[model samples]
Target: MSTQNYLVISALGKDRPGIVDELSKAILNIGCNIADSRMTVLGGEFAILLMVEGNWNTLGKLEEAIPALEQQLDLTIIVKRTEARDSTARALPYVVDVVSLDHPGIVHQLANFFSQRKINIEDMATTSYAAPHTGTVMFSVHMTVGIPADLHIATLRDDFMEFCDTINLDAIIEPAQR
Candidate 1:
């Protein structure tokens, strides 16, 4: 593995089809390899987040390309070099995926559960889906959590399961390797 630096880029604006095509083309034109990315429509708006890797000195290439990209797409772009990617890598991270029928208080219920247990949430994405015409709704959440090695996984899972049953939700926990 290369220990070279990279950049984390993110952007958000009104939802429009083909935003991905435009952004990807821009990054490629500047000669950066995208290492990882997530682009989705969130609340009537399109949002894009990406990790780009290239020689550390080529950052100027990105800066120059962003302004024209923003003007062409009418979207805001934020980019930051990942010079300290491992600064917080001392602890292992675990991912918890939760899915349940749409209902009030689902997010708060699950988020509060983690808060009370002192779990660190690294990243989370929650979205609600509506069944066409029928109007039925469902909610799904994918969250990456950081659990210290000393934490007991089984006990934590059992505790969550107890309430998951009453809420009609399913939860799964898995370790994410560095």
Candidate 2:
């Protein structure tokens, strides 16, 4: 009997046509199964987030192959090992969406707040664009968040309210399940 290990990898670099193929093939050759993934273009960069499961014997093989692929494709690869699932119960995940005028600090501000509250952001997508004479680009972000049951939901809501006020941005935070 054997237990499998999961590795999470994030890939990012300048956007190009075949980056996905290169990474996908590399994963296949290493005998790992990509359990989940999201690949998209953001701010002229192609980024991929993948969760893959493989045996220990092949883990190093996969890790070693990444640098070669990186050099050939001019990209950066980040990989980390995931811990075994916790046996205890976990809290339900939540959703937090924010949209505002694009500014230098929008991401930084939100990230700082999320970190402070121990909110695990499972996934996030952000985009921005400028309108004629608008002077500032509009930015939109959707985040899938997880909140531990012990945390006060009201506190999270209050934090968002305060953050919104300080940034002059509109935000909505509510029970993810109604």
Tens-digit lDDT track of model 2 for 34-62: 88899988779998898888898787788
Candidate achieving the largest TM-score: 2
Model 1 per-residue lDDT at 32: 76
What's the TM-score of each model vs. the native? 0.75, 0.77
Candidate 1 regions exceeding 4 Å error are 1-3, 87-95, 130-136, 165-168, 174-178
Error of 1 at 116 (Å): 3.6
Clash statistics: count for each candidate: 0, 0
* True-vs-predicted CA distance for residue 2, candidate 1, Å: 8.9
lDDT of 1: 0.81
Error of 2 at 98 (Å): 1.1
